[model samples]
Each structure stands twice: as C-alpha cells, then as structure tokens.
Target: MPDTALPPTIPTAPVTPAILESLRAIVGDKGLIADDQGKQPFVTDWRGSIVGNAAVVVRPANVEEVSKVVKLCHDNGIAIVPQAGNTGLMGGATPWPSHTGIVLSVGRMNKVLNVDPVGYSMTVEAGCVLQTLQETAASHDRFFPLFLGAQGSCMIGGNLSTNAGGVQVLRYGNARNLVMGLEVVLPNGDIWNGLRALKKDNTGYDLKHLFMGAEGTLGIITKAVLKLWPAAKDVATAWLAIRDPQAAIEILSEAHGASEDNVGSCELMSRTCTDMVLRNIPGTQDPLKADTEWFLLLEWTSARPKAEGAEGMAEKMEQFLADQMEAGRVIDAVIAQSEAQARNMWVIRESVAPASRAEGPGLSYDISVSISKVPEFIERGLKAALDILPSIRPYPLGHIGDGNIHFSFMGPKGMDRETLKQYSPAITRAVNDLVTSLDGSISAEHGIGIDKLDELSHYRSRIELDTMRTIKRALDPKNIMNPGKVLRI
Candidate 1:
C-alpha cells in the first residue's frame, strides 16, 4: 500500500459547465461519463483499495477525438489522467481525490490495424487487450511474447506505459522491447506521430522510449507497432520442488545449455503462495506434492516443429531434471505431458495475485537485484521484515531468472487492516533499505505510479530525479499530463 495523499502542488482547476459542454461536443454524450455511479470503476484502481475522483470519464473513439479532447483540457488548465484498461497494480491510471478534470480512457479505440507475418510485426491501437493481441499474433503464425496475469483485462497502452515484464521476459524482453514505434498525444494537444515499422532508424534520438515507461506523465500512447516472433511449435512446462532460491538459480543457470537456449520462463514460488492460490482459486491443482518450501515453474520453447522420431522438449527436460536431481539441487519435479497439464501448471502461477487479495490485507514489493544477489537479498530482507513484526507471514516469489521478486506478506492471522498498517512504515523501510544496500530496485516490473511516488524520491539520487523532472517539465509544461505522477514537477 502507498500514501494516497495528494500534493498541493498539482493543478486542481475544476471542469466548469462551459468546459463540460465543449468536451461533450468533441466526444459526444456516448463518450462522456459524468454521473458518479458510471464513473466509479474508472476512478478506482483494480485492487479497489485506492478510490479516486474524476469530473468525467472521457472515452475517445479515435486518435482525432483524443487530440481534440486533450486540447480542450489544456485550454482550461484541467488535469487529465489518461487511462487504458485500468488494470495496473500501481495507481497510475486512477486520479487523485482532488482531481477535478477528466479520465481520458482509450478503451474505445481497441483495434488491430495491421498484421505483417513476413515482416514479423503488427500495428495496433493502444486499447487492444493483451490476450487479444497474443491471439491475433497466433492467428498469423506469429507470437507476441508479452504474457502476464492481467492479460485478459490489461490493455497494451498501460502495458507499454509501464514497460511491463512477464514470464516470457527471460526469452524475449519487456514491453518496451516489444514496441518498435508509438503515436502519442502531447499535453498541449499536438500529436507526435512516430509510428514507424522499420527495424532500425539512426536518424536521431529514439523518442518512442521516452513515453513507453513514462507512466503517462509524458503523454498518452494511442498506437504502437509491436515486434513479433516465430510461434513456438515445441514447448515444455514443468513444476519442480527446489532446495531453495539458490538451488532454483543453479537449476536455471544450467538449463540454458541443457534446453539449447530455449528457456522461456523460470518462476520461483513459495509453498505459502502456491497453497494460497489452491485455497482461493478454483480448479487449480498442485502440480507436484513435494516436501519442500520452494517450487520452480520452468518452461522451454522452440520455433522448430518436433519430428516424429526426434527427441522433443519433454525428453530433453527429463534428462536435465535427472541431472539436477543427481546434483542434489532438485528435490522432485513433474513435466506437463499435455496441453491441459501445462495450463494447470500455469494457472497455479498466474492466480497468485487474486488469491492473495482474497486471503486478506498484505504487502507486496516488486523488487529486483542482480541475478547472483537474489538469494542474499531474500535472506536478509526476510530477517529485517520479521524483526519488526514477528507474527507477519511472508509469501515470497518471483521471476528468479530476472532477479525480480514479489516479496510479500499477509497480516498476522487475525490482525485487521488498520493494525497491519501501523507496522507498514517500519517494515517497508526495513525491506527497502536492505534492497538499496544490495544495489537493488524497489520497484521492478511495477512502475513509479502514485504508489511508489515517495519511494522513488527517497531511493533515487538527486541528479537522477532532477533530470527526470527536467524531462517532465519540458514535455508537459502545464503539468496536466498525469500530474503528481512519476515526478513531482
């Protein structure tokens, strides 16, 4: 949880009756959501923890409407919160309590403009759902590697804005890496069209990257040209009971050579997290019932189709697991023999967030350190957090291959929300301090939305913060583009 308090420095100019009429003219009544009841879902975050207020919810049907609407807000000095699917864990899309402007939602612009299988790329609107894009890629015999738990509801715009990373990051990369170009709506209502599909352009500074991870503080991403790849024909998914985090790392380290450079994902899960999912999320079964605290979900993929007589991913994975067991790193493991079995294994991993929500009040940190330092950081971090609240239960898991951990904890057995919050400050400081000492990041996959606003200022250097503020000021002079986000300017 983060401090939901808004700073007094942000623009709070209310959208008067005159401006409302102008907005309606630009997007029409169908695009405008003014009533409080219809605006609740847009104002609140996905967690339902951070409820905010907005003058209206504006859903633009196209980039032209988006441009005109932003121009109106700019003329009136009204703050705007550009939203996509509103599925971000961080409160980036949600407006503040003092927000008196509008939420510019691009959900109405969902469209796949083009798909070029030979070029290995696709042009899409920002509002396109992640799973929809993945399926679109599959239809053309290509693959979109960005896969996340929120893919069903999360939009491509938010994913790229936050530079989201998921299971496939180990093989492909982050959301930013997937994008080749972008079309943005500037704060002053001018459109900066950089939506090119070229593989390389040495013309000048690559401006597309400036907004991809800016979390909408810079501008709104309306369209993107995303890079695609050959669809996987041979893939393997496995569940393993590992000795510990260190063992998990060792297994992954050797897996690169053993899998012939086809490691897709390597996720580490604690028994507490797995059991929590099983208890809350239905139809999710335990893949392997081993007497261990830590488990690893390993996957391997290849573009080449498997021949009838040739050994496939399963055979190779079997031999590798056998070698790991002989080395005493792997306690026990199970390879998914069918697609249904693979899906079951993945359900256990992806259902963690919702399951945690159902369990109760908790804290989760998306932090990352060097691949080699993950074990040490986890060890010290657990001790530091436990020292403050000995009764708190820890649920630690991560993309171990990328050194990013969702270090989390549920409140003490019967402790209430307020009670848990009392110790949050101390516990948060202890965990974050340890991460800093190890030269790790406090916010990894999750961006510096309102949740990490203060944390970013506290952890980042003065020079770095100053440089970021300079960029924010240059791009959004009126401070109306997601004000009080990413930077204080």
Candidate 2:
C-alpha cells in the first residue's frame, strides 16, 4: 500500500462556480461533466482496485482545446490529471479520492491524421485506440507492432506514456522505440509542436523521452508520430510444454538461433496459469496433451511471402521444435496448422489475466530482471512467497523472453476477501525484496503511479530519486500536472 495519506482537499485549486463556468466555456457543456454519475467512469480504475474523486471530468476534442483547458487550470492554480483510455493497471490515471481537480480525458481526440506508406510512419491523435491504429496500418499493407490484451481499449497516448511493452517486444520493441515524435501540452497551457517523424535527429536533449514514461507528471501528450514496419505475410505459432523455467529460457535461445532472431513472441506461462485459463475462460483448451510445469507460446513472423519450391518459415519452426523434442527439452509441442488454429493458441495466452481474476483476488507484482537471471529469480521468489504463506498459490506468468514477469499469488481456496486482502502488503514486500536484490525493477513496464511511490523510493538510490525529482520540478514547476504521482514532491 502507498505510505502517503491522501490530502483532505486541494486548497490551491478550489472548484468554485466561476471556475467551473470558465472550464465549461472552454470545452462546452457536453464536454465538461460535473455530475457525480457522469464522472463515475473516469474516477475509478479499470480493475476497480483504485477509486478517485474529481470535481469534474473534461473532454478535450483537439490540441487547442486541451491547451485552453490546461491554461485555464494553470491560471487558477488548479491541478490537472490528464487521462487517456483509463486502462492503466497502476493507478497512474486515477485522481486522488479527495482531489478536487478536473480529469482531462483525451478520448474524443482520437483520429488518424496521416499515414505515409512510403516513409513507413503514421501521424495520429493521442487518443486513437491502439487497435484502430493497427487496423489503419494494416489497410496500408504496413504493421504497427505494439499489441497487448488491452489494445482494443488502450490509447496510443497512454501506451507511449507508460512505455508499454507487449509480447511483440522481442521483435518490435516497446512503445518508446515505436514512437518517433510527440506533440505535448505543457503545464502552463503552452503547446510544444515537436512532432517530427524523422528516424535520426541529433538535437540537444531529446525532450520527448522525459514524458514518455513520466505518467503525465511533466506534460500532456496530445499527438504522436509512430514508426511502422512491413506487414508479416507469413506467421508460425506454436505451443510447447517445457520441463521448467531453465528449459524455457534455453528453448528461447534455441528459437532465436534457429530463426536468425526472427522470433516475434516467446511467452512463458506457468502450469497454474494455464490451468486457470482452461477452467475459467470459455473456448480455451490446452494446446498440448501431456501436463507440464511450464509452457512457452512461440511465434515466428516474416514479411516475405511464401514462394514456389522454397522452404517456408513454418516448416523451419516445425523442424526446430522437432529437434528440441528429440533433445528432451520439450515435453510436448503443437504447431498451429492454420491461422484459425494460431488465433486459438493465442487466446489461451491472452486469457491469463481475466481467468486469474475470475479465480480469486490475488496480489500482483510486475517486475523485471536480466534475462539470464530470470530462472533464478523465479525459483528464489516463489520459494520466498510460499515460505511467507504456505497456503498461497503463486501464479507467476508473463513476457519472460524480455525478463518481465507478472508474479502474482492467490490465497487458499475458500478464503474470504477480507482475509485475502490482509496478506497483500506482506506478499508484495517479499516478492519486491527478491526482485531488488536481483537488480530488477519493482515496476517494469508499469509506471510508478500512486500505487508504487513508496516502493520506488525504497528501492531506488538517493541520487536516482533526486535526479527524477529535479527533472519533474524543472518541467512542471507548479506541480499541477498529475499531482501526487510518480514523485511524492
């Protein structure tokens, strides 16, 4: 839990009638939602774990409107929380329960401004849904490889803001690598037009990176220029049953070696995660026949189309799996015979989240370590967690290819919600301690929202935390941009 207490009220930013009217004039009546019922959706997080309170919810339609809203709040000394999609796992987008500021939602500004197939880049509004961007790129015979379970609802702005990493990160990289430029609205309501779609720009101090994972503490990102890739014309997906985490890592290396680093995604899942998905999620069945302690969902993609009298990528992947099976590293494997089969195989991987939720309330930790230390960390961390509470069922799973793991655990069956909630803090501490000792991040892909402020402060050094505070203070001197987030300052 967060150590800091919520402020009773924001004394600086009083939500008076005149101030409300001023804000309404900028975004209009429909855009400014003042009723509690109308603001309900924006106040709460997607998981319902964090609930916030806001004086009003403001929807800005364009960059100019966003600037005006920010400027109005800035002049009045009011704090502003910029939100997009509201799909963040960490409480980054949620306002404090006692906060009396406005929630600036960018959902209305979603649009694809331009697509340059020749240049292999696309300019889009920050509020554009990630799935929509993927579809737009597909229409042009190009690919936007930033994909995740929440892509259907998550916005590009939030993706870039969190520097989101998905399964394709092994091949395409995270959101930071995919984005080329950004157009942000500063805290003082000034618009910085830095949206340059160039691959190489040797300029002084790349300012765009400051806000990429800042969680809106520095500025509000309103638009972005994203890099695209050639569409994958041939794809091969497989589900392999592995003996253990060590074997999974070995197979990942073997897959990369066999494919010349063409492997797109190599997802590792624990047996418990697979069982939960199979039981809770409908239409999900185990891809492999024999039971294994660990599983690896592998995929290989290539832009080259299949040609006559030539070996395809799928054939090579099958041959590689056969070789691994012969070596006894793979207990069993199933290669998707068709695209439909491939999608079905992916469904099991994607259903891990919802299925785990349906199983029971659990303590979830998103951490990362060096790729080589993954197996060791998992071994030690799981033992540490079980030692703390033997009844706890650890369900650790995630993008192990890049060392990011969603190490989560649920209480024993039939445990009440209140009892389960009591173990959260202790469980979190044990896992995080192991992660820090391994030189790993407490929050890997997830940004430090209000949820992990104390944890970050504890794990990071004085100089590191001070440098972050210095940057935050310099960019947002007033401290009105997403106040009480990232840094407690």
TM-score winner among the candidates?
A: 1
Task: Write down the TM-score for model 2.
Answer: 0.97
User: Which residue segments of model 2 deviate by more than 4 Å?
Assistant: 1-12
TM-score of 1: 0.99
Model 1, 1-489: lDDT tens per residue? 365335637798999999999999999999999999999999999888888889999999999999999988888899999999998887988888888889999999999999999999999999999999999999999999999999999999999999999888888888999999899999999999998998999899999999988999999999999999999999999999999999999999999999999999999999999999999999998899999999999999999999999999889999999999999999999999899999999998998899999999998899999999999998999998999999999999999989999999999999998888889888888888989998999988989788888888889999999999899989888999999787777
**149 in model 1: Cα distance from truth in Å?**
0.2
Give me the displacement of residue 231 in model 2, in angstroms.
0.2
Could you estimate the TM-score for every candidate?
0.99, 0.97
lDDT of 2 by residue, 334-354 (tens): 889988889878888887777
